[model samples]
Target: MRSHLLNDTTAEQYRRSVTEGVERVAAKIAATERPFTGVTVDALAPRIDGIDLDQPLYDTTAVLDELEEVYFRDAIYFHHPRYLAHLNCPVVIPAVLGEAVLSAVNSSLDTWDQSAGGTLIERKLIDWTTARIGLGPAADGVFTSGGTQSNLQALLLAREEAKPGRDGLEGPASLARLRIFASEVSHFSVKKSAKLLGLGEDAVVSVPVDTDKRMQTLALARELERCVTAGLIPMAVVATAGTTDFGSIDPLPEIAELCERYGTWMHVDAAYGCGLLASVRHRDRIDGIERADSVTVDYHKSFFQPVSSSAVLVRDAATLRHATYHAEYLNPRRMVQERIPNQVDKSLQTTRRFDALKLWMTLRTMGADGIGRLFDEVCDLAAEGWRLLAADPRFDVVVEPSLSTLVFRCIPAAVTDPAEIDRANLYARKALFASGDAVVAGTKVGARQYLKFTLLNPETTTDDIAAVLDLIAGHAEQYLGESLDRAS
Candidate 1:
């Protein structure tokens, strides 16, 4: 038996390894800061092929070296200003250091025995997050992989709440003719969760969105009425705090009111936009988020944590008991008598990471205002981008700027056919990425294709956006045979 493995690695060893790793990663990040093009992939692949899988893996040094080469080298640099493709962004220093510490400790946060102090840390964070959402001190939640798992877990709770005394999710009566309400523009994760929860995809009712892309509250009421008339139990209404395609916020307070009136659970999937909680400028948009029965927020998206740090908060603490199970020896007698809330009682996973430390470190070091400023800065930059696009005859912004993301299409004057506009937007977005000048994504809004930019980095500026726009315009002029004067 290895003495190091038995006693756990020493603090000095951990410190030395982490410091070295951090420096290496930082240098790698700096070197690959620019938008990577085709040449590097071909150059790097040949070296990767030289690796022998049959070799015995022994030391952490070799493991870290390989990771630095393949994983870190190939990974997209979200910190790069030109990589404005998705919600992902550069992580903060505090959280990065916190991950180092947490990995050194190697705590399994599933149970009290496994986690110890880690259990307390995670619980406190959950309590703090619950309080932020207007949930009472009695409310509880567990960190999840991301918003999807959190959403799935929320639906699972709803299922259990709807069907009491059921052996499993079987029988027509046990299933409870259930239906969920969400905006037509809301994430498909809701539909996926519904199906996984045995409600079937048909059970997710797509409520209409107004011209602003917000879920129409009146339309939701009508849909709830229709479901009730059809003898279906209205399980829940999901409101998007920040929708995926367009960062549109559904009328959360209004949706909460309807949920209250109809006696249905309200689950807010604020995965992308929940970081606005830190921002005073945009917090009002998610006003009634506190009233939600459950809420999903991803620290990975907004808090600048690494991937897989997400949370699901429920308004009632006792509600978590719905997912509880007991394995005699593991959580037996005295352990259960101690009344410690085993994290496994609530989570979907058995060996969960100590993700709370990252957020805790971030909040502790940066203070609330620091993170809030990042959120505000991103939203402000997005609005600036929207304003730029609106003023320019070359582009058409889909909706008013809501959060960090803005969707717009490049419309040339001579192109009356919406088809041509869509084609131009698609080509322009692709052309910008392919040229390695700048990066932005594309999405469809009501049959029209539009370029999408989701800016999460506070360092990204209006100037950066303008450069991308110019590239987009140049792409249109080159490919679509449209002159600058013809750009609508």
Candidate 2:
């Protein structure tokens, strides 16, 4: 056990074990032919369940060999060029190396003592992100596990700020009257945050979106007025810079104005669109993001970093006080007086991982412009995909992508039944998944099933998009034929 520990005495053992593990994973990646094996739970679960955790494999190689049967074989390989499903990006080598170093060090990011340079690195990264979003000099933030946490923290601050009379929303009576405004297509996190904050499900007022799937500013303004007229407090207006299904960015500048007029907090959930901040050609797409009182960015989604790398930034650094708590032994009040920078002061979490190191390494290795080019490639690929879908007679595209996602559905000309068309599209996605050839996401646009291509891999080319479309069409056509046979 001591030999396995990563101490100076066991440095050689640590190097050997980690190197073996890395090589094993590298080999599996190199050999993976598809994004996944389309593995079924029934088949794989039994193998995992059969493992006896009480028994230990004395050797690392033996443990890795055992892992091959359960974990590695069927794992989804996002690095594959054909992996067009979801917002999972192919991580850069630099980020992966950073992951290795950080995991070995295992620094807790909550306090300065636990993470010395780590705290500063995270602050620097937060500063870099806020600067990119034009959050101004007084802006400050802390890294979160992901977008959901970031959104939650942002809304929590909004709730606190909405409290009036210096005592704050003062009581539960005021909490009951608080409301959040968001577009119908905004991330579900907005509503989830409302619930976690003790607001009712109805607290999230769903404003309508325009033809491009963007939140209609007029509708948002009307909602804000209605809330005030009814004596309800408009806590916050969540403006999504990139909707998951359609990649539609709401009208940010207009939303910001509405928030100001209503004296509400404006939060831009740019988890998906934050990549545009690094984009060489498309930075102007999210022009009004700067006006947000708080912004949520998921580097995992767009910056090609690993999972769990995200930040919630604010225009006023003081607003983070809503999440702050001073512990006697941890972040004591005296620490603030001492001018110590503590990440736990701004985070909802305690004892968080040093996830900022990955982004730091990525920036140091490739620079932001390198990330911009990678993100731009994916966005460009999505445009080409949209063109292909628009030209194809068999599919209907919902909207042009604002980032790197395309939502479209296969509509068979022979099928007049909308429900049947929906079934064909659904069947195509499932069959393709079961076959382990390609993976795509499914969503409903106006109660109709649609196939989605969330292009996050830069290596995924236009030709791959065309190929996936052909596969989807074939599966859909096959399903239509099967339905006809069954009907006959």
Candidate 3:
């Protein structure tokens, strides 16, 4: 039937398939009553494993019917208000439309000829973001998969820049002396990137954080001085614009001054706080970001866009040439000589998806200000949730949020034993997830178990927070009671 090819004969079939698929998705979204359906891995795995791929259904309806039972029935819905889990956002509608178009067209954004208009669109969006970040005229960037890749690329550039002048003995000996500094609370990707870059685990030095969980600049200055005395090269100082667990933003202005003084590269991981670029009122939070050598921004995390919307911006555009590779068949030296705008020249990837269209459509439909307001809404909700947690006396709310995440653990006044409280909090989180009424996240701080409420949904109200808090408290008390019964 040549159904795979999208020619004139298969055009009607394509339209019908899209209509049916979207209808099913819409129905699923509308019918989802909970954030999760509480289906365990053991129960779901067998159903999926039982599907005989050799036996083809040969009909889209039959395939979708099987998918409904195996996948859609228990899928977690991030759009639901009760989903106070991860950094997943309920995406804006325009981005969803962009996804449909990009998927059908299947544009590859590596070379100029393959993309053309797609390349220009991505460049324009990068320019817009750079302007918003105030990275100056020489600033340039490229869209990446997410923050991890962006951070890796940023550190790679820093390592290349940190190379010692050749004196006939500059191979492994000099590379071993290179060190990267980051706050203890910074993303784990920093250490992982160091290892991938052949620097090993010892190359990363963790700087201490203050009581507010922000990196202490004075300690950082001291570390830099120590590095100079020890004949170690400080390759990069990675500052966190938003930490995952605490949502605390390190003091960037002070850190930037330290990096300048030490002649070290500054890389700001603004994956979670990049929404401030659009924030009219709170943009000052990332004031020193423009001074950074490089910055990582994940629009997917905070811009109300779907997954895979992120970019790595560099202050001096020439720095991106560090990632450039001349491929014979793709972005060759001849293309560079011709001044062709091949995005692959600045990317760590070859066959990249046109993920920028999602952000472009989102910015066009809901202007930058609209996304900022949505971000502000969630921050406001976090404040309310914090107040509720603080007043209830059941939860030991960690600190006031700098963004939309609250890290706290259940600790009723009656539960005096610290160990028991920790166990109870852990038990409560699992019980809530197993019940499937709501979904929340968990983390640990200083060997103590903590429950996290990453409020990314602006639609999630104080009422929803209260309901989840009630569930947490109930489960905690029940767990404690059960433990006491077992003890007796």
- What lDDT, from 0 to 1, does candidate 2 have? 0.92
lDDT of 1 by residue, 375-475 (tens): 88888998898899989998888888788898887777766878777777788877676566667888888788888899998888999999888888778
Candidate 3, residue 198: Cα displacement in angstroms equals 0.6
Model 3, 258-346: lDDT tens per residue? 99998999999999999999986788888899899999999999998888899999999998989999989887899878999999999
**By the TM-score metric, which is better: model 1 or model 3?**
3
Task: State TM-scores per candidate.
Answer: 0.91, 0.98, 0.98
Tens-place lDDT digits, model 2, residues 318-417: 9999999999999999999999988899999999999999999999999999999999999998999999999999899999888888999998888899
lDDT rank order: 2, 3, 1
Q: Which run of 10 residues does model 1 get worst, by summed lDDT?
A: 1-10
Clashing pairs in 3: none
RMSD (Cα, Å) of candidate 3?
A: 1.2
lDDT of 1 at 300: 94
lDDT, residue 286, model 3: 86
Give candidate 2 regions above 4 Å deviation.
Answer: 166-168
| Residue 465 local lDDT, model 1 | 90
